[model samples]
Target: MRRIITTIDIGTTAISTIVAERQKDGGIRILGVAQGPTFGMRRGSVVDIDEVTVSLKKTIQEASKASGMNIKKAVVGVGGTHINTYNTKGVVAISRADGEIAEEDVRRVIQAAENSIPKNPNREIIHIIPREYKIDNESGIKDPVGMTGIRLEVDAMIVDGSKSALRSIIKCVEGAGVEIDDFIFSSLASAEAVLSRRQKELGVMLLDIGGGTSNYSVWEEGRLVQAGVFPVGGTHITHDIAVGLQVHIDTAEKIKLEYGHAIPELFSKKDVIKLADFGLNGDDVYLKRHIAEIVEARFKDIFELASKELKRIDRFGLLPAGVVLIGGASHIPGIEEIAKKELRLPIEVGKKVNLPQPTDKNLQELLFTYPVALGLVAWQVNQLSGDNRYFYNPTFESVSSKIKNWFKVFIP
Candidate 1:
């Protein structure tokens, strides 16, 4: 039987679905992709299950029809203000007659780290990525499966989300008649799609600016150090434009996309455009520079908020790989230059590069707004190739087996 994977990205602005097949030579072939306007979501969290389910069903049906495959299971991306992340460490004695670390021992240590998370009724752990391992007195070890050690320890990053929010997302997907393979953090998924291995190793930050939220993640020494979601996003810029120019939201959105720039200095003050060009039904003309000022203000706020997060983690302006911007808002003219100036770091707009072959030109355009969805499928492919027991197949044989596999993380 041929192996196929599908992924759904439920974002604030749109729902994206992609289906791909794993080739015999370990390459991925894009079979189909679809996207539609998302509803009942704000800042990446589902507010209405019925509306989200309807949108999801349509998205999945479109992709399935295009790919000529039934969409039964998929990995989903989740993000929003409800998401929380932090670091923790766990230690345990190797349980063996000869003091040798084994695969079970690794699992135990990770379990120990998981146990350290505070049990809160409102919160649930979604991801536990092992950052590094220490065996006996040795530290900074990536793998110690066959090594002899009396003491085994691990440091990991645990991603948690609001229990109610998670349940809402799960219920919506299940209602759409699709079973979820797993839930991945939205920013982490975007990072998987756009970031190079070398950038992660050299310390980098990824900012995915969507419609209602800007999700971010920092990586250092080949491991995720921090991840978060900010409520401000491209929609805020549009709102600012609407209020400043006294135009409808739809008209403001069109203007922002057609003429917006993140740095006001790059635009000419003398260049005036009529509001009627954007169907605003007004005779007044506005200078491009004034419009850019509004965009620059919002962009500044987003970058400064991200800078505060880096400061809190003591990694501000320290990352050699600097900042990589992705998602819908990343297309704003001069956004990268503004981000570099605001954060005092190197900046680049991120693009998808890990796909082995993508035949559809439309797929390339969707990749910008659908990185999280594409990353979800890419993540599953990596897991299967690496022989991940938890996600080896789409369905589990029993409840016990499912429980055992459910909590596994992407860290190796």
Candidate 2:
């Protein structure tokens, strides 16, 4: 039987599973998908182990049933404030073997770089992405293999996360009876879904506004430049609306989705919405301006947070392709306009590609919310088939081994 790859995205508000089969043409055929309301997670961190396990099993079982395949292993996405990155450097004496560099040389240099990472008890390195490689006196070489050099140097960005957080996610998957092939950063996964080759080459920022958190990844010259996660997200907006309008959380959420606009003027004053629950006098009371104000205030705050993050990275005006917004909160009306105004760059809503055409256009419109889930599936397929197109290097075995060692040091 042909093997299939599954990906489970246990996000802040939802757990989604996707199954895909490798195709002959090096592409993926999505076999099935399932999503359910997430439990035991808040702001992208696993909190309740049992709740997360139940949700994971339910979503996985649904997807497995649809695909008619038993998924035993998967690539999962991890994101939270605990995720962090730092720069590290490594140098190695190039062996004089016909004056040519080999893959092993590059791998050794990476391992040397990995040595620079501090063995923190609470954190483990998740990924080591080379920013640039230098061979002898030559600088800015992306690939060192097959090059002629006496000394090799490398600068890499090391991504690390809290050991407890990672262990929680791993335990949840194991409890669900699924093996974790790999754990990908949530922002990185979202970047894979919406960022184009040109965008990465030219420099771009991917901002995924999820239910309980907003994650960001910066790409420049076709490499991951930086990544981060903020605790604020769509849930904050709902909370603001609920408090401002004196309505229940569910009602506030519905109001935000149905009539929310980042810009108040985007919704006309004459266009009124009835709020039966929030009304002070009557059930049919209408308040168009009030709702717009509440949404606009929350959106402005979210955009301002994004702006601060961009400015802190000094990439506010540097990204050639600007910002690509994905995830559930990106569905808010006028969000693109808000991003453009706040970030002072081009903004567009990101959508998931490589999916079958849906009969319902409305459902198609909602696909952008599933970018992380879809990207997880894409990452899983790449891992299963040894596709290194997404990463700078392609070998999973070497990478996994390095991470395993790092995990041991971190957890111990």
Candidate 3:
């Protein structure tokens, strides 16, 4: 059985796409991967449908050329400030003559959790994942089916997003001539590619720092505990540089990528370079230390908020596996030190993908940054195999292929 899936991860700065062929052993072999410019988006939400649609089309076409595979449908990853998460519990009476909780009981309790969601037509629930189960006096149960209990309960993590924002993204994908097979929260998708089961079980935090927003999620005892999106991201650093140096946005971006450092102390007073040295201008000269200072302050703005959020949950410095940083912005040279100093935890940039991956040199080196896109393809494989320990996948039923008889379901 062969299962090939394509995925698109839309960020404020860029759009990432992946075409992968799932092997018989349930591993992903990347056929194609590409990164393209993103426009008409801010903080992960679509601001201009027309601009995003055009960008999506070009990115998909590029991926097709790279993989030599026709791209038609894709699993999309969604994240932004408009997305919200809640930790909630649901209760129900078990329906069994022997007082044992049945499969239906579990389903009913989960539905009850969904019912706890506040009624907002403007918002749609995208993920309703079970955190733990409780049977009467017993709590912290991972699985409750067939357990003897009169009362059944479930603690679930619910993620919902602005309906209008989601619609705008869907319209852009469809406008690009690609059907949406399924949609997932961006952080959840990243977790699939970089986070391991051991990390989840021991407690870990993943921060996916993008251009416009920093998306973070927490897992404890192998369940989603908390998650959120911060409006601040790497773009803030670019803006700081542009304002400080009186440079254009494009120049600021280039400087940030090529010479930006998170720690100012790493540079010396004599370590200065002129614009002409970077092929920009012949006269203007600046200190690299100054550039690093601008970058550090903007990052402080991001990490301060993150620290506050961790304090709210009482998980600061608590995760044994510490913090795993992914996404495009996390690729900066000395970011882990900043993360460690502010977060006060053991921090390491996420690398070393577990998937049976592509051999392209650039794509192989960039695999860490493409977790969300890679995870979307992995999501499809997990769906077929009933692997719910990582993410509870809601069916992506709309515009799904009308015929499903061609591929045999491969279960590992």
Structural similarity to truth (TM-score) of each candidate: 0.91, 0.89, 0.91
Indicate whether candidate 2 or candidate 3 has the larger TM-score: 3
Query: Cα deviation of 134 in candidate 3 (Å)?
Result: 0.5
Report per-prediction Cα RMSD to one decimal: 4.7, 3.7, 5.6
Task: Estimate, for each residue in 1-412, the C-alpha lDDT of model 2 and write its tens digit.
Answer: 5667787888888888878776655565667888999999988899999999999999999999988989898888888878887888999988767869887788888888888766776676777788889987889887788889789999888777887788888889989999887778888777665677788889888888888888988888877778888888888888988888777798888888887777777556677867654443456544666777787777777778878878887888788799888877787777888779888988887764533222223323435656876677656655556654335332334333445565677666
Tens digits of per-residue lDDT for model 3, 301-337:
8888888989899999999999998876687778889
Model 2 segments beyond 4 Å from truth?
A: 268-270, 277-286, 352-367, 384-412
Between prediction 1 and prediction 2, the one with superior TM-score is 1
Which residue pairs show collisions in model 1? none
**Candidate with better lDDT, 1 vs 3:** 1
Each candidate structure's count of clashing pairs: 0, 0, 0
Error of 2 at 189 (Å): 1.2
TM-score for candidate 1, please give it: 0.91
Give the deviation of candidate 2 from the true structure as CA RMSD: 3.7
Off by over 4 Å in 1: 355-366, 387-412
Candidate 3, superposed: residue stretches over 4 Å from native: 355-366, 393-412
